[model samples]
Target chain A: MSLVRLCLIMLALLALAAAVAILLGETPLSLGQYLQALTHPASPPGEVLWTIRAPRVAMAILVGGALGLAGATMQGLLRNPLADPGVLGVSAISGLGAALAIAGGLAAVPGAIELSALAGALVAGGAVVAIALRLREPEALILFGVAISAFGGALTALVFNLAPSPVAIAEILAWLMGSVENRDWTDSLRAIVPMAVGAALCLKAGRGLRMLTLGEEAARMSGLPMPRLRAYAVAGAALLTGAAVAGAGVIGFVGLAAPHMVRALVKDDPRRILWPSALAGALLLVVADLAARLAPTDQELKLGVVTALFGAPVFALLAWRAARSWRS
Target chain B: MTAAWTLNGVSARLNGKRALDAADLVAWPGEVVGVVGPNGAGKTSLLRAGLGLLPLTSGEARLSGQRLDQLTAAQRAGLVGYLPQDRRVAWNLPAEVVAGLGAIDLPEVQALILARDRLASVGAGDLATRGVLDMSGGERARVLLARLLCARAPLLVADEPIAGLDPDAQLLTLDLLRAEAARGAAVVVTLHDLSLAARCCDRVIVLDQGRVAAEGVPGVALASDVLARVFKLDGALVESPAGPVLAARRL
Candidate 1:
């Protein structure tokens, strides 16, 4: 049942990605023309369709899927529905990394920003785990994450402030706001490998997580080494966050909102819900990106702004429902 | 006939506090041992330490000649089943799914043995599809007890297994434990109900202030003036329909 839904959702997202790429630009193409563009390799439309729009569409899927999977994985590990890389300092650190690369003029070398973003994500993720380890309570770890995220945000602002040119600041700001515009196949490849590897590792660790949900002692009693299992899950989240942030500056809510929404639908069966979560996350980002591109404005709004606008209210509704249900 | 477990001067400390002090115990196979104690008397600590769930400050516990820590969880899993106090499982899962957890490695036939006989034994056969969170306290207790039995381990360590259970469920749970011991498992349960302990257990060990205050046959152990003194109760035995029951009245 879940597999069929996942396939359909992936197909729908693929359709949306193609639509966003082909129809949202200066010269909008009809479905027939889009098909013409997709097929006719020797024509100018082929280069325009394949080169510019295809890579952007591909990047959207990869970044969206990565964020969604990572978000769901984070929620499962922490047992918190609201947890995501953005709220937990992952994207802020990635922003910091991207800023440093741009501010230091290293993006001229190509892939520097991606590397820096990955590094920042790793550092932030490691710091969260370290802080979580130090604290006696899970709530303490969340609070500490907020504190770390604030610090990273401040550092990011400092790096942006020190940029030598307005162009650099504009680029950094736009990237931080997150968009799939002007991306290429090279960028998609940079993100896909790490995200795929990370998601695979998370799937491998899913069984251990089921044992973990039974509580630490039960997990230990069930033959799981808690420390190692936690490390693997944390590392997987960090890697996925890094890849997504590296691919796009920081798309928010895909990580926090996706898994919770999936759980809300699937009824919290972790083993069965993983792919649904990943696909749902991908579909969310694709739709959000499409909205960002197609909004009837002179200038395109940021993808993050669209997702946050859509996701926040939905998340609030869910939270309210959860709270009300919890009371009952 | 064989000793299922032996503790040699086993001690446990938690955060610099001596929770259990130099405890020695021998659990013979196919015997039901009940541990009774006042609150904070280190009863749970002793069981947890013996099961190798907690670190021992000193001494050691052996399970059928094997060091407790040396056994892998799966290997030890085959030897002992431990049910802790206040097990908080997500109630959204069905009872059978929770029961399925205990049927980890046993052959299909053995799993069937548990599902059929043990569920009926604990009076939880009707609750196979019910959600644990949705069940009444008595029902959840029966299901959990059934899960413990499904492990088919040689030893059972249950901390307050009958707390919050209704009288009928409590009796049925005890009866199930007795049947488990008859199947050649050493069953150790920490309990608050003195009458249940007296009726169900072959032997009893009472703890007070982190030490074994008394250990022996239920009647003799509960009859000890020392237990009355430590428990600060007007201890008396009542002849009940079930058997001779210990009645502890407030001093």
Candidate 2:
């Protein structure tokens, strides 16, 4: 399909996904009732729609979009298709920060989770930055991110096992697993500013990232400053990932899935894939949230689990194809 | 004409081993300088150091009278373009996109047009839209050559640029380098082909064991005695109608 047609399809799917999410929740509101709740705020359906579902939907979309754009930015900067916010330990660090806020009673204060998550993400992202800068070859940076991810995961598990209360343990586990079940507009409001700013920065850095696809020597000759550009991209990725994690706990595969799927749709042009990836990511998470809310099972699936279940196989297939293409 | 670059008492050492030892060289505007050496003779190291990507162990290299390390990335970019020995395209991005990236001010269409015009001057226009991944080795070389040209910098440093080209393409590549020099750009290329160096470069530097064994016009630098001692080959310089050529026998 042509790029324009593909973009139209992506947008249409997003709209459909949003509509389906609105109609399929546990409250079982029909399309008309949901429409009434959204358009006519004073009606009987207003409480159900405005109070609970709207915020949930908005939170899902915002967090998903953030993860998607962050993933795309990371992949482009690293020049490695497999790189993602979660895979580099950025999310784990953010989760640690959120857990600290909740467990330490900081969440009693308004807006603490967001600040805590941002701190965690910055710390984790900073470690990756330091390591990437230390390496001479780009491949070494990839390895370093992998190492950081593994170490971060271990640290998170240790912290969870040491929780003092059953409630604390459950919250930590739920956050680690990733969820959007009880999130409201406040969560989305908390994240929107950083996500928007970070995405804008990523888009501005898109041109430089495209030049870098030709390798460092070529990029330098094309007028890119290696050290500064690398720092800019890494900071952009961290901010986007940090905001998403702060708002919605730690959604794992959205970042990995969104960028890869968008690349598949748009042919790996960084400039073309930027916004589409964000939109598609928002769509995917909204749909996943809908499924999590209304599945036949009593226990709702976590948002992260749904994405990981769906994303891992598709991601593997794309990665295999990429490797084979490179080999040839 | 002003000197585009100069290296004085410069040396490069990697992993405690001397890669380039006390090398002194100067390239003027509109000059074609070729460096020839064996595999470990430090041709790539010298280019990297000169470009300020690598620091000199001692002494210094300068671009347009400013020390290379003192120049900002943009200032250096306006001064020099470097093509490393290995060029990789991480994705199957279109070739025109790659070349157009060097245009500082034009839109993509205008950049492509300007890049194609420059490529056409070097016999490389037809391959503009081809994917770098799908191209043949010679075709990739030409595309990268187009990319190098698009920089429009005063100095061009290409390391083993023609290693993958066919014989005919090799000659065209040399001609392109000559044309770049003729346009007032300082051109430095490292090559395994002595004949191409002898035919194209105004001056040649021959390196042996991390030091300059010979430096001068190609005919004088590639003399039989130097080739025999430094390159371990017995070579004769024969006067052709066009110029002097080097014919060598394996040691």
Candidate 3:
């Protein structure tokens, strides 16, 4: 299929998923109310649609797309099919930040938790920028990310042990489980700038990734700016994951599964696969979030939980297919 | 005419061992140059250092009279097309996509069309749509050859261009290199088969122990004494009905 058509199909699916997400809340909104909410600001439907459902759905798109694009860039740059945004540890570090903020009683503040998450992510991002600029091999970046992720994971478990109250524990665990609840336009606005800038930078780094397919020496010989491209891939991926974590906590699986899903539909050109992967990611997250809202349980399902449940099997199938080449 | 690329008194090390020791090499447009040596002779190192892909421990390499350090990536791409010793295509991208990578500055569609044309030139036109990993060794080599052709650069360097090919494919690859030279691109290749080098190259450089043992027209460079000293061969460059062939056996 042409890239434009593939993108359009994914967007259409996103629209369908969005409609379901908006209409199926605890308040039981109708199709008519949702459509009416699009323009009538004074109506009851407008309040729920504009202030509640809209922002939540918007957050899913932004987060999902960011994670998707980041995954594709990482996989391309490292030339590892199984690579994902979380491989760099941005999510775990940010989770640590959000958890600390919750334990500090900052969740009540309008944006304190997100600020902490972003601050945490930026530290990891700083390390990435330094390593990508100074080092010659990409494997170094991977190793550093693994080390830092372990540190963050261990520290966050400590934070859970030191929580002051059950309420604080519940709030921290809720955020960790990942949700778009109570997110507003401000959160979406905050996430979009980084996501946009990050996407632009990652997309431009395609030439370097394409040349790298020829292997390192040949790539350098092609006159590709290997250092600059490395910085772009890591920095772009960092900002993207940072935005998602800051806005919606740590939603999982979308970034890891989106690119693998799209590769089945498109040729495996790193640059060519990015856009469709992003749209597929957006669709995946939106549908996953809708499933989170509708699951038959006393408490609502976490977006992260729904995504992992849905994504793991699909990802396994794609990865299994990919393993065939290793055998042959 | 001025040489297209020149490595002057270049010495380089790989893995803390001397790979190229004070090597001087040059090639001109419309000529096919071959570098021949034993496994440790540093033919790969010489080409790599000359192209500015590897750093020089001493001496300078220049392209178009400008030092390698002074050349921008765009200038380098325009000047030389390089194929490394290990032909690793990291992904299973389509053959056309691999070929198109030669000219990434162009739009994807334009690059693909340009690559398709080059693939046709190498007589592997049918391989363009197939995934490279699924190809046989010979098919993969031609696909990579098509990638080199896609660059259409003024100077072409390939390491072991015909090392693993059968006799028929070997001649076809050599003929393609000669054709590129005919089109006025200076083509450089490393060959293990001395007979193939004698038959195909306009001039050949014999490397021994990381130094140039001899360099001249094939008949002079591979003549008996140098052959014995460098390759431990007990023979001479003999003219057959087809062309000059290295008639030798292990000493």
- All models: lDDT? 0.76, 0.80, 0.83
lDDT of 2 by residue, B1-251 (tens): 66888988888887689888998778998999999988899888888878876778987999888888888878888888878787677766667777677675567778888778776766767777667778877777777788788888888889998887888898888888888899989999999888788888999999887788899998889988988988888877777886666778878
Error of 2 at B145 (Å): 0.8
Model 2 chain A: which ten-residue window has the lowest total lDDT?
Answer: A132-141
Model 1 lDDT per residue over B1-251, tens place? 55788877889987689999988778888899998889999888888888887799889998877998899877787777778785665324556555655666765456655665666667777777666667776777777677777777788888898888778777877887888899888999999888888889999998888888889998788884855677888867688776987766677
Model 2 Cα shift for residue B194 (angstroms): 2.4
Model 1 misplaced stretches (Cα beyond 4 Å): A2-26, A100-105, A109-112, A123-144, A158-169, A225-227, A264-267, A321-328, B106-121, B136-138, B244-246
TM-score of 1: 0.88
DockQ scores for all predicted structures: 0.36, 0.62, 0.63
Q: Report lDDT (Cα) of residue A73, candidate 1.
A: 72
By lDDT, the better pick of 1 and 2 is: 2
Q: Which 10 consecutive positions of candidate 2 chain B have the poorest summed lDDT?
A: B97-106
Instruction: Tell me the lDDT of model 3 at A88.
Output: 65
Candidate 2 or 3, higher TM-score? 2
Give candidate 2 misplaced runs (Cα > 4 Å). A1-12, A30-44, A103-105, A129-143, A264-267, B122-124, B234-251
Clashing pairs in 3: none
**Per-residue alpha-carbon lDDT of candidate 2 for residues A23-44, written as tens digits (9 for 90 to 100):** 5667766768768877998776
- TM-scores of the models, in the order given: 0.88, 0.91, 0.88
Residue-level lDDT tens digits of model 3 in A22-124: 7667777677887777779669988887788889999998999988988888778767575665656778898899899889988888778767887787677
